[model samples]
Each structure stands twice: as C-alpha cells, then as structure tokens.
Target: MTDAAPAIAAAGLRKSFGALEATRAVSLAVPPGGRHAIIGPNGAGKTTLFNLLSGALRPDQGQVLLGGVDVTREGPDGRARRGLARSFQRNSLFAEMTVAAALMTASAIADGGSAVFWRRFDRDAARAEAAAAIAARVGLADRLEELSGNLAYGAQRQLEIGLALATRPAVLLLDEPTAGMSPEETRAMQDLLAGLPRAITILVIEHDMDVVFDLAERVTVLDYGAVLLEGTPAEIRSSDLVRRRYLGERTQ
Candidate 1:
C-alpha cells in the first residue's frame, strides 16, 4: 500500500436481510495510524458495518480495502492474516484457560503453530515470551495464572484485546471495548487504548460518548444505515444536525 492509502476503507457497502437494509451505501476511510470511531443508536447499522469491514459478512454490494488492497471477498481469517484483527463486543475467550495459556494459544495460532498440539505451550520459549509481553501490554501480567472466566469483567475485556493484539495487526477493530465497564474500568480501558502504538490504526464502535470523544481523532456518525456526519470530535460535538439527529442534548 502507498503512504496515501488508508489502512481501512469501505466503499458503497450495502447489506440487507430481505427488505431490511442494514447498511446503505456506507463508505468510510480510516487513515493509517488514525483512531476513528463509529457511533449510532441501537439499530443504526454500526455492528453491521463492522461485520462488512472485518469480513464477518460479505457486503451485497461494495468493496472493502485493507491497506489499499481489495479484500471484499476475503474471509475473516484471511483478513486477519493480512494484518486486520478484531475484538468483539462480547468476550470471546477460553473460559477455563489461564490468561497466559490463552494468550500463548493466540500467539501460536497466529504463528501457524496450530498443529503443535502435543507440545506444552510453556515449552516454546518464543511463544511464551510473546504471550508474556502481550499480557504485560494489556495489563494482565499479574493475572497470568488466573482463569480467564474468573477475571473481573474489565480484565476479561483486556484479555479479549490481548487476544487481538497477539496477531500484531495493522488495523484493530474494537467493538465497544468499554462496554459493561464500571467508571474505573472504563477509565482504565481508555488509558490502555490511548497508549497503543500509533502505528496500529484503530477503529472503534462505541456507545459511550466519553470514551469516543476522548479516544477518537475523528468520528463518523451513522444513522439509518448511512453516515450522517464525519468530523473531528469538536466539530461533531458542535454540529447542530448531529445533535438533533443522534447525539441529542444529553450527549452535548
């Protein structure tokens, strides 16, 4: 990809289930190393758009470009291998596995070591070190031996993000990273995300205005399956149209 190309871009994406169009001509471009956010109400096609971008679902009509390469037909794994990773809104983890084990598994899988099932993960020095680094990066180093299912809700969220980071993605799609977090947890998550390396572009779908406003360099407001506004946080916050159509006075 050239320097001018966006890390993630969607063009004229459209998806429908029978008569209900989930996404309507939605298009966006996230610059390399940029932090962007997508926000809308419950049925505003936010997650649907993520699905299309992340290769969870194919768009009926559109193109998805990853690092300037057309990947509309790529599957999730293919896209992931091509430097795109995602964390779901809900935790996706091995509940019974220790945090260290789960991160090791993620790293091993990313390294195409899935067939080495007979060997203990801790025996692989490379993978172990990688896993430990990821754990520290996500602030879970203290809980390495703890079961993933037993982690506090926020820590589980952190582990989920760690799983995504194991792949060393160029673009990370975070779907409500702060969901279900207490105020303290939310603040911690915000700090963790803000500290991520600027080389990794981030696209977040969030309902929490505080997180969105604080972390996003630019905001895309989706409403009725289309972009209603795309601007800096200050501009979005001040847009009378966005306030009337979505943000409302409460978000202001």
Candidate 2:
C-alpha cells in the first residue's frame, strides 16, 4: 500500500443476477482518509456495489482494490485482515452477550486470539481494556455491562459500529449507520461518526439526505445500476440530473 494510493477503489465493476444487471460498469476511488457516500433510490444497486467492494460477492467484471492492492479474489474475512471493515444496516450482535463481552470477543478475534470457551474474557486485561475503550468511543461506555440484546435500537447500532472499529480498519464501509434511528439518535450517531479519526477512510451508503450532505465530503449518486454523477456535496445537491433522477424534481 503506497501513501498515494486510494483506500478503496473499484474499476469497471459489473454484476448481474441472472437476467438482471445489478451494477453496470460501476467504478469509484476513495482516496486515503477520504469521507465519501453513495446514495440512490430503491433498486439503484447500492447494496450490490457494496457487496462487490466488501468481497461479499464477486463482481462479474472489473476489480476491487484495497489500499491499491487488488483484492477482487479475497473473501470478506480476507479483506478484513487487509484492513477493510464493514458494518451492516441490520443488527449483527450476540444477543446473549453483554456489550463489553461482545466487543471483547470481536477485538480478540481481530488480534488473532482464539476463542477459548473455558476462560473468562476479562481475564485478558488488555483485551478488556481495548473493549472498554471501544465502548467509550462508540458512546456505550456506561452500558458495558448491559445485555446487548436489551440495548435500545440506537445503542445497538452504536455497538454494531463498535464491532467494526474493533478490527482497527484503515477503511470503514458503513451501510446506513443512521438507519432506524430517531432524530436525536441520528444526530448522536452523526456526531460519533464525524469524530472518528481522519486516519481511517470512510465510505457509507445512506438514504438520509441530511446525513449524506453533512457527513460526506464527496457523494456518488447511482441510478438504474449506474453512476448518475460523482461530485462534491454542493455539486451533487445542485445537479439538475440528480434532482430529476433521485430527488424527484420535475424540470421547469
């Protein structure tokens, strides 16, 4: 990985589900430390593009590069090992575990520690401390002992992000971190994401225009499985094509 390389890039990525082409020649490059967002209406292929980039699905064409190294062939775990981490829109949690325990487990796995069922997690003081720090970072420090399944919807989302952070990713891909949150929760999540270290590049797929406009330095608009436009937030907001295709505006 060179200093000048993009944190993540896709070149001519294409995917088809049988007869339907999901992503049509989609391509993007997110520079190191860049904050970017992908937005579109329903069925715009945003999820398919994310799957290809995260190695959840292989692209029918083109390549996925992480830190400029081609990773098209790598699976999700392999990409994770290479400093790419992703958070899903739905909750992925250990329902039976405490918030601290869940983060500790994720951190331990990321550090190559095997799960030894016979041992207590807290016995590993460093891992516990790391988990606590992650809990703090994600705004769950005060809820470390709470059962993960019992957390409020917003806190669960925060913990989901904490799980991703445990991997210490160089590039983080978030799938609608603010989804399903109240306005207050959304604002809190936004601030938490905004406060993340600039050393980590972020690429998010979001439907909330407020979050998109506020959090993303650059935005990519997708329509009908292809990029409608890619530009700064100001450019994207003011784009006549974007307005017509995505924002539901009629031409004068």
* Cα RMSD, each candidate: 2.0, 2.5
lDDT (0 to 1) per candidate? 0.88, 0.87
Task: Estimate, for each residue in 111-222, the C-alpha lDDT of model 2 and write its tens digit.
Answer: 7875454146657788789889989999999999999989999998998999889879999999888888999999989988888889899999998888888989999998
The C-alpha TM-scores of every prediction are 0.94, 0.93
Residue pairs in clash, model 2: none
Tell me how far the alpha carbon of residue 78 in candidate 2 is from the true structure, in angstroms, after superposition. Answer: 1.2
lDDT of 2 at 248: 66
